[model samples]
Target: MSDANKKAIRTAIQTGIGVAAALPMIVAASGVPAALPWVAGALAVAGGVARVMALPVVQALLPSWLRTDSSASRR
Candidate 1:
């Protein structure tokens, strides 16, 4: 697939992950009960994503805009 397509997929995945991580916190902070389970699930998902992101192959998939090096060639 093209770089732009890959970048869009990556962005959408990360946005979903961000929303998943935030939902539990928002619920808990709002004084909702039974949020512990949701928090635990979100934590697990975040941890798994973090580990996957640390992989060299996964890092290679990251968009240039999201890279720490910030040295992408300009056209």
Candidate 2:
């Protein structure tokens, strides 16, 4: 696969893992019903996909000082 595609998949997986790990704590802190956590997990996955797809645009919009160098180049 192309580098860009690989990067996107990596980002999506990382984001999903982060969201899944945080969901329980978030739900517990808010004292919301248990069923709502499933909805939150779904939203997190959607948001992760959207963010991965938009990453290039986001990087372009950020100022140079705020942007990190591509770590993939170091691999």
Q: lDDT tens string, model 1, 7-34?
A: 9998998798677557657666877664
lDDT of 2: 0.64
Model 1: pairs clashing at backbone N, Cα or C within 3 Å: none
Best by TM-score: 1
TM-score of each model, in listed order: 0.47, 0.44
Error of 1 at 38 (Å): 2.2
lDDT of the candidates, in the order given? 0.66, 0.64
Cα lDDT of model 2 by residue, 1-75, tens digit = 999999999899777767665766776787887667676666566667556544765555555654444532233
Most accurate candidate by lDDT: 1
Look at candidate 1 and tell me the lDDT of residue 35.
41
